[model samples]
Target: MHIMRVIVILFPLLLASSFTDACLAAEVLTLAKDGNAKAVIVLPGGATSAARETGGILADHLKQICGGEFRVIVESDLKDASVKDQRIVTKSTEPVETFILLGEGGLTKLLGATSADLGPGGILIRTFPNAIVLLGPGKTAPSDPYGTRYAVMTFMEDSLGCRFLWPGELGKVVPQRKTIKVAPINFNYTPRIRQRRIRMAMGLGERKSHGVKRLGFTDADYHYFNKAAMVTTSRDGGWANWHRLGGSLRLASGHSFGYMWEKHKDEHPEWFAVQPDGTRDQSRSPDRSRLCVSNLELIEEIARDRIESLNKSDLNSVSIGPNDGGQTSFCRCDECRKLDPPNSRKLAGGGPALTDRYIYFWNEIAKRVTEVHPDAWLTADAYSVYSAPPVLRKLHPNIAIRFVGLTYTNEEKRRQDREDWDAWSKAVKKIYFRPNVLLAGRRQGTPVIYVHKLAEDFRYLASHSLVGTDFDSCCHNWATQGLNYYVCAKLHWNPDLDVDALIDDYCQSGFGSGADAVKSYFLRLEDITNTIAEQQLKITQPFPPAVIDELRGYLDMAAAATADEPDASKRVAFLRSGLEYTDAYVAAFRIFREHEAAGGGRLLKETKQRIREALDNNWLVSRGIFENHHLAVNVATVAWGSWNYFGRYYWSDPSPEIRAKVESR
Candidate 1:
């Protein structure tokens, strides 16, 4: 295999002295063997922050490797720079040898370009020897990024040895031409529980958890989470991060979560939700709050605006609506009552009528989105109040219903949890009536609580008829913890994957064969940690101190299991210390719980003292094991305890200073 290397070299002195820095910078980048060198075209269109930063980095790298005069053109300049034959002109007087076309698909379209355009008869005839096209980090048409990039890279390497670099570095390659396998990938609707397990097991990467929220209707916060997903997905090749038109529009414009509904209510004050005293409801932000979907015009206008804006982004898929929680209450205005005659029967305390309106409104929105972006995918979040089996209007075949299952409270509450899932599943079946539904799995409340149920749900969903699922355990709230991200990645790719085996693989990859025994001990430690952090903590009622002691003994047994390892003396010591630490913490938790249950000034003082002691002892143990174990253990301790401690103060009526102290630590 012949590989053509383009070495870009930089002259710092020339750059410093140039008056026309931007233009001169362009001219200085041309290849040394003017006529012998190939023509290179670089173009960048609408870019996300990450894409722009990456472009700048690539440009800098090129400058350093290929020092000389070079002509650089932006995507906007393509039309003006083209000749009668449609070949892009080279500013250099010398004939070009290689051509590099860089930009997103939108910019490429402007150039009247295709992958085949780099061929002999196509445009940029003189620069056919070497041509490379760069995509983007911005939200783009799904097919262009996934299909186009793969196709172009293969074509470029075959036709001209020029490689494409955008997402990141392609490491050392063997010279031999080996056969490659290509698989067809699609996003089918997966069950919610399965999605949660995969995502949780992948562990919190940068923005994975946010991806889950984005999959719901919280578009405003999607970018923050998407950044994290992009980094993690790129590193571990399970799936590529997708950019949708509707999502991109919301992100770029900084639109609020429920902006569409809010805008309508602002124009018509009569559509606002009314309170018992006849005053307009103002529970959340009045300016950008939800509106009554009673008025037909309001719904139409919102649909039109959202559809048009999304179409402009050139995206083909998007998840619609807000975070899946709260009651689906709208308004009990006269127009709403007239539109919904059934409201008369369900209007007890004016609650049912309001709830009915919200369902009607959401179903209408889904209908409109399907109409506008027919080829695009639309996911309606069947979460919170919308989980029940209400009459959903007909939808386009292309639109997929996503059932979002959130387990925040105790997992053992089968009655409530099953009812929630049954309601959502029933509603989805009523509307779509197909097994091709996707489940958006989320574990709300505390991180520890969510992770515990998430694992159990993953196994449960995997046994059912699920198309695909998205996991959201790695969010801003959970990133600080020592969750097993590698395990999560494995589950994402295949939910039936054995987590223990995955952990073993991760340990081997991170630490070589010399540390196999250490890896085995850590894997065992992880199982123990999950058992304590997830399973044991779920019991609703308080346990006796003896029960706590029994749990401590079990942890001690786990520690003892590793004592006989011949090659892991250090691991054995660390395990013993961890067991001691857990024992002390469990004892402290029992005391704190007892005091908390009793309630009062004495209990408050005792709780504070218990926390102080636990923190002090744990901090010391953490320091001692810092060099022996992975950073994950320490990070998990902080992440798991941070929210738990803080929530105790807010939810359990602890002193204000308790939260402050935990936050500071």
Candidate 2:
């Protein structure tokens, strides 16, 4: 009665319509009150993939709540369909007693909302006793159609207490109910950051042990954002651009160096990076790939390949940057060196700063690409030695600079990162962020958790013109840094969100009764990471004996805290994995030291016995973490990589025991 009494000022004339009159005149739509109520999902005839997905998502939840009474109908087809008992309705012009509206047309028609009212990725939700309307941003914005989808997820999470922790059944938490209830409500939300993405590396195959594979695009994994690492057509036929949708049109990354190397290495060796020795260097760089940035012909070749990709799809941008890895892979030829400013940060002998040539090369390439794709963008990374902004010339407006995340634990490096962000923000018109939170290759040691720092960074950068974010992580990092991963996603979506509240929600939802233990565990890990960073110690370096013991003690405490919660064993195991990994490495290093102090015989036998115990514990930890062997495989790689440092002395020996194991492998 109250809702009917209050007329929406702008919609007075529209209320005269039968549908509006019925909606305003009826009491609230009682879903499943008599077990005859049905939710009618109404969609535009040619809706986007996101619209279809969001509609289905809402319908599925209604079915769960209303006990299987729901119907999905395209708006155009609604005329032929029966709706005698339809309670929840979406975007209908016909005079319906109770109706819900979603997206642009519904919001503008029912609530008198203009396109300018909702910015890109913004949503408006208003509720009456009998009706609800969920409005999302315009469809043209890169994140668009998907922005409405995100609104759906946010609604479920905020109102229904649904939590999608990670991909897969284990990570989804949905509340069960026989009847869905709606209360009067009003809320609006807009993402602080435009781009929220995750790039995971390991396997694309259907390996059960691979977390990324298990998570897939949906299956609980895709519950968060719009972009992913791979590209494919959605089931609804709309584009699914995982990495910078409307941007790069490729499944793989770092093509520039590889393409030039493959095309010119044999015939045009000079087109590759020139070593300090005046010889062509194609193999010995941080990225194991380099390019002759000064070669105009080589730039043309790279541009041509990009054009080919653009022709295949209507991608809004392309990446024409250095290969993945540190930026010490630039050419050292005299012509390339001419672009370097004096007092440049040198790489190898008589070479200029990597930034000097990187900007010049990209500027040249951007010029050519802009001529064709004027509205499109060209992306480049400011990483490692080239992390600093260019000193000489400003980047072109068409160029997008991705400021890769640098050291988080170290104070000086953190300051340098902010400096880089500030300088580049001023120099480049478009900016995208790629934060590395992985401990891959030799950097694998103690797991680092920089939750506070990550939140701070996101908040700080949101003030700048940040277009998007792609969080780069290894397989183990994602599982081990579970809390950090959750926090990062929330911050990217809304930088102003209370991070402490998010962290609390994550620990409670993830660990349940054992939340306190898990929360303390991560806090301790962050403390140790900060200490290590402050001491200027690399995680890959061997820990001091006392530090190793302290870490082991923390692991024991975490294990004890979750020991009683057997149901949460998987989560607990994943949480403890990084520590376990570090502990195993420490124990191995200790054995190596013992061997150094004493020759073979009894010491070797005893150490081997201890190592066997450690290995056995590792398998349990692995199963508890990933429920499979991928983490074990990753750990094995770390061990073998460090074998020469210690493992070879014992594991590789020709003695009977070692020889038998080696031969079996």
- Whole-model lDDT values for every prediction: 0.37, 0.57
- State the lDDT of candidate 1 residue by residue for 1-665, as single tens digits: 12111100111122233223322222222233422223444545554444443344333333323332335555555443443333345455656544455544443454444434221111111122123444322223322233223222222332222221111122101111222111111111111221222222334434433332322213333333334323421121222221110111111211124554445445666555554456565445544444555667767765776687677776554544444333434455676655443532232244342324445665676578777666655455544444433443333454445545544333343334445455444344222111111111112111222223344555554444343444343322111122233334334433454454444433332223424553444444334434443353532122344543553454344345445533233323333444444444344455566676777344466576666666555444433333233221332223233324534533322234643554476
Q: After superposition, how far is residue 20 of candidate 1 from its true place, in Å?
A: 64
TM-score of 2: 0.74
Residue-level lDDT of model 2, residues 1-665, one tens digit each, is 32232222112333343144434354544444444443455565677766776777766655544455556556565544322242334344554443455565532354443335555666665555455666676556554445556555655555545565554334445555665555444556556566666654444333322322322223233212212322121121121121112222221224355455555678888777777677785654533467777989888877877777667866677788677654344566788878778877654454455686688888888888778878777878888657777888778888777778566657777787788799888998877787665443323434667788778878888888787776675443444555565676666666765666676677676676667766776776777677766886655444556765675565566566667765355666654556666665566556555665787455556677666555444333432333342332244334334444434434432245533553465
Q: What's the CA RMSD for each of the models?
A: 14.8, 8.5
Number of clashes recorded per candidate: 37, 9
Query: Which pairs clash in the backbone of model 2?
Result: 18-95, 19-94, 19-95, 19-96, 22-97, 23-97, 89-100, 228-242, 246-316
Which candidate leads in lDDT? 2
lDDT of prediction 2: 0.57
Highest TM-score: which candidate? 2
